[model samples]
Target: MKPSHAIQGKTSEIKLLIESYGFVSPAIFGSTASGTDLDGSDLDILAIIPAGMRGKISLFDIQHLEAELEALTGVVVDFNVENSMPDHLRPPIEREKVML
Candidate 1:
């Protein structure tokens, strides 16, 4: 399933999963957001950890959330931290992302 379509009707679940891991401003980008996803395409998701909570969240927590989201959406998930991403990649992704 397309990432957007796979997530349909699952907003509350997705939100809970995101919040449990201390992430906020969840959004979809790349092929999923651009409506260009093909079979086997991975879901590109951006989630932010608030400045105050940054160090409190662990790499394990992030991986756990990624696994959970992949299970929920039935797609490979490429989860990323918005703040930690390199500068050059931000513009196009920000322009295309669909906030959840």
Candidate 2:
């Protein structure tokens, strides 16, 4: 199955997972977003936290979410936080991201 379809099939679970981790605006980028994902391709995820919740979250929380998501999808996951990412990396990801 395509990566997007795999993700879509687990959308509700993913949504709940992200919300539980205080992440909002979940998106998929890179190969999965562009429909070119092959088996073993890592899933690239971008998520933003609401300003109000930012101070409450920790790195461990984010890493836990990443691991949980990878377990859920049975694929490697590369999770990126929009707020913490370098400015230079934003535009290209934004250009290709598919919102979840």
Candidate with top TM-score is: 1
TM-score of 2: 0.90
lDDT by residue (2-89, candidate 2, tens digit) is 5666686797788789888888999889999998998778888888989899789898888899899988988888888899989999
Q: Give residue 93's error in model 2 in angstroms.
A: 0.7
What value does the lDDT take at residue 14 in candidate 2? 84
User: What total of clashing residue pairs does each candidate reach?
Assistant: 0, 0
lDDT of 1 by residue, 1-100 (tens): 7777888898678878897788899988999899999878899989899988979998998899899999999989999999899999999998999888
C-alpha lDDT values of all predictions: 0.88, 0.86
In model 2, the worst 10-residue window by lDDT is 1-10
lDDT for 54 (candidate 1): 78
Once superposed on the true structure, which residue ranges of model 1 sit more than 4 Å away at CA?
none
Whole-model lDDT, model 1: 0.88
